[model samples]
Target chain A: MRARERILGRLRATALPHPPEPPEVASWYAGRQRNETRPQQIERLRSALEAARAEVHDARDAAWPAIVKGLAEAKGVRRLLAGSGSPDAARLAQALPAGIELVCFDRPIDDWRDELFDTIDAGLSRAKGAIAETGSLILWPDAHEPRTVSLVPPIHFVLVDVGTLHPDFHTAMQAGRWAENLPTNALLVSGPSKTADIQQTLAYGAHGPRELIVLLIDEEGAGK
Target chain B: MSQPINFHPVESFKERGRSVVNDPAQRKNFRSAMDFLQGKRRAQFPERQELEGLRDLASAIRRYSLAQLPTLLEQLERNLTANGIQVHWAENAEDANAIALDIARRVQARKIIKGKSMVSEEVDFNHRMQEAGIEALESDMGEYIVQLAGEAPSHIIMPAIHKTKQQIAQLFSEKVPGVPYSEDVDTLIQVGRQVLRRKFAEADIGLSGVNFAVAETGSLCLVENEGNGRMCTTVPKVHIAITGIEKVVAKLEHVPPLYSVLTRSATGQAVTTYFNIITRPRQPGEKDGPEEVHLILLDNGRTQAYADAQLRATLQCIRCGACMNHCPVYARIGGHAYGTTYPGPIGAIISPHLRGLDQTYPLAFASTLCGACTEVCPVRIPITELLVRLRNEAQARPDSEDATLRGSGAGRTKLATAVWRGWSLVYSRLGLYRMTSWSMSRGRALSPIDQGAWTRSRTPLVPAPKRLRDLLRKRRK
Candidate 1:
């Protein structure tokens, strides 16, 4: 017999009597955030992100490229990688400081995975939104901005607009209703790659980005 | 008396557990690791009411999922198929391993990089792959450490928790191509990174374990801190996800509470660094992600657990490792001592069903029924009650009236059954109770000093001078 039939058959044969209706789940937190105003949400998100060891910069709009450049310089990164066709990518390309090398995702990662894994010092991508409750960045990596742009590089740089912050993951998922139109992959990244495996010593950059630098776009003067 | 030391299939849990408890280093390691994890979980769920609400909600979600498991699994298969992904089913561990090996051979994969999958460990996947001459490397740092030491993961989340940092440093310095005897945490991580990076780039196939399989969207959710899961699923040409059938949920929203409690319970993190929601294989214009994605659902003995209403609670586990973290017996014995892929409280219950009760009698007996695991369980599995039930099942005769249970246990030694039976009979009779109490009190000095396994690590037990009934009667007089 086919494995599927046999397994499912056993499950059904041994199945216990269950209620006809599936039980209801508590979908929302009663008061996940004390205040839900745009600025307060941003403030809460920044602190939460910072607590997870992610560096959140208070610059947005036209100043994004300059802040990203400054971060790259601070990290001693010679090459900066980003996905193609995003407005953020265009702006970054235009304001490139002559010294650093910038590579955009035009070809398939299959063609350049080794180089991306080995030499790419930083990967900058745009965050679709931010979850304030857990301090996570929601990135719906698509054709233009592949998943590797946020994953492969040693330092992962994300562009987060303060207004896009949601009080918690549930609130964000509800508003997005991602089931209607979901990307191939959606990532909720709270911080840099880390491991507490060896004696709970807590080391960063085990297999992903060593550092996570967030360019928090405070378009609403939320910066304290 | 001459029994060769057998190790592979986890022979004799009592022997292994005794050795673990005897080692001061293992005891100290477990103490610090469990304390750190427990503290993180305590801090994560500070608000008592909120934490309870979440736990209740998580438990309800799991209950509802198990209730609708068959329908949801069918839905998941349909959705995944429609999303250009192949879904296969395995009836047992050998079947699952065979399917993987067949796929590997067909894909002509010489090198494979695997993310941390406890399920894979259950199937002994790496060994099977190596026997087929395929190099399957573990990408998770903890898993890699255990793999390097040629040992199984002692803890589920922190696989290398049994080993100290100095041991890890020595292993890395000796095993890794270019590394000194550096005890620095960062330097050690770098050494692992330098070695695993090449493997990730060169691997032909990526193997992962799904945390949650969303039936609503046919997406596989993987939660990780190291990002190796993402790499294993993205950098490779083909990605294979192996999961037990019970991992599916009805809707995407069901994930939030479960995910919330799972992270807080497992490692005390508010949320893991990365939560990858993979809906499909790479699209036509997509520049990254696996070209092919396959999810293999293994039933093994899970269906048997689901068949019985009382035993169905075993399927609700999300592999959070919270039960083990809080279990007093597990805290002292450690994961390796259990002699199974899963150790600790959850293991004590599930190992019987998965490995069969006859083979896992020692595992079932390796518990104190402390109820700490039940109290801390996010899904609120009545772990202590389950342990007691398993004990009864274990002691049951094969042809007994109660042996009708699908996963009903048998094979308790005749000696043990007689001892317990004799004690029970004597206690229930007033005549026997009085006679035995008087005799035991008078013969206290002549009590047996060697209490077998009980006295191995603990002081031997002897009767007190007076029984409660006798003392009360004397007071009344």
Candidate 2:
């Protein structure tokens, strides 16, 4: 353990008691001052939401059909779960074969059991907002929304309303402040749940859905 | 003899990528997993303006931190030492690896559990540890998958973006013999959780990557979705955090912006599921933690980049993987194709510099220069510009055909070559340029051919309506 001690010794030599100055923090808080007004901030938020929504819709429309086809080909996908606020989730569910089932939930439910939802082939939810920078979707836990609605199902279909997309991450947090009290649990998902734990080989859907289908919906385009 | 873990960077990358891409079932699994995450992220934050603000704040913080990195690192080092945490400096990959290996050997540690430190990946610490006969086990789910497959990560956030559930089922069936073949994700997670818990408890040393190293408090921050990192750090007798020198921020105040941005940029969460801040090992009154804490500050060519005025900006990267997620090239080919510890657009630029141009020349040519990576970079590293710079560097090699063709005095055989050379000569001398301009203006009456190769695929340049000299003369009249 001589090597450990030496490494530790070096560490000990470099340690100090407190952090550096507060300029960086002050600058950051100061920067927020420019867009401090609620109306101005809301307008910015609205535009950003519109842009994000449009992008999400475009991505979803391009990828959804292929995802649906792929899911249709899977072995055990009879019943699917869908959330409210999804643009085409209802329509898509209606379009499924007569024998298949679609269960819709308005919000998260604490009493929901994993096994009940686990048997389903897929779960569908509407994204509250999407971060374009990381391709992540944010989800909040609520009374009607069972946590397993997104996690237990092997296949997950997410509906992204084009109106609620953000280009970067900081904006997402700023929006979070608008919520009086944030939900107890929140999820930010980038890609399919995966692991490269075994000899550094990738395996998808390790503890969550194995398949992901994002449907970006442009409601205005329906009229077009 | 144990099979030699060959480190053929290129061939191995291709082989790994080919397997991942070819697996249709794996792709299905990835699609489903990403969909779930996307759904969750959306539900958490329904407003778009908030995310944008977070991004801006995050970018600003990273830029500020990078500007004062040298100072911040010194402060962090001092603070950490005062807190009874040992810190070491590694100038390069070899030094970093040697230092870590020496620590393991000193402890007579045969089993080491790692908790998702990407810096260790940069130095290929696992290979070094195995070479030294120390069993290195990855406790994180993603790292464990990579470890089991003998492959590297394809995505920084989700290392196994390319693998599917069926493939994992097959792998689990083979590796964990008693585990039944079940496509259920929960069952698989239970199995992994059980297996890793044992590994965590048994490991002699725990290694982790630092998310943020606060200079003010000498605290190392780790953010994770699972509690694995916490377990690995707290359960082991010794804890070692390996991180890049640039991870340091001057004070605790700089941390909020970074934390805000890192979470949103990484997964679009207001905050990660777990954010653990450890100031030092277990103190006198502390109940549980490692007996000793060690932090390794790895330069590994970062200082070289830091010294170069043009390259120093790159040190601002926070490893958020935003550029990778948005990059078209990375989306198609994945991370392994970059053939480096770091992958994606950032990797394309930084890897060659760190590994040497000769070893990583191909990576420089990997990008389409789409500029998307730069637009999304939390720290605004000018990734696309760096990629182009790397390309120019690659072209400068003596063996490059472009170099031979572009080099002076090569040949005047081709008409295009002669014209190019003549143009260059004329441009070099101001007197010659004036004469050429006069002649060109005089010859404007003659129609020029549209056959110039440069104009073939683009809009032909419009002849100057009139020379500046002509314009001046007309004005006098």
Q: For model 2, how does the per-residue alpha-carbon lDDT over B1-477 read when each residue is reduced to its tens digit?
A: 123232434346555545656766654544444444445445545666656565665666665666666566777888789878888888777888788788888888889998888888888888888888888888778677667777777667777666666776777777875988877666666678668756766788999999888776787877775556766676667788999887887555556567766666666655543455677676542323576788998866665555555666677788887777676656656666667778877776666557665566556556678787777666667887877666665555355543321121221136645676798999999999998888777777563557475475676554575799889999999
Q: For all the models shown, what interface RMSD does each have?
A: 1.5, 11.4
Cα deviation at A49, candidate 2, in Å, is 24
Output the worst ten-in-a-row residue range by lDDT, candidate 1 chain B: B1-10
Q: For candidate 2 chain B, which ten residues in a row score worst on lDDT? A: B404-413
Enumerate residue pairs that collide in model 1.
A14-B307
Local error of candidate 1 at residue A124 (angstroms)? 1.4
What do the candidate models score in CA lDDT, each in turn? 0.86, 0.63
Candidate DockQ values, in order, are 0.76, 0.04
Q: Please state the error at residue B210 of candidate 1 in Å.
A: 0.8
- Decoy 2 TM-score against native: 0.60
**Top DockQ: which candidate number?**
1
lDDT tens per residue, model 2, A25-87: 444455545543433333343344333221222334545644564455564578777654455
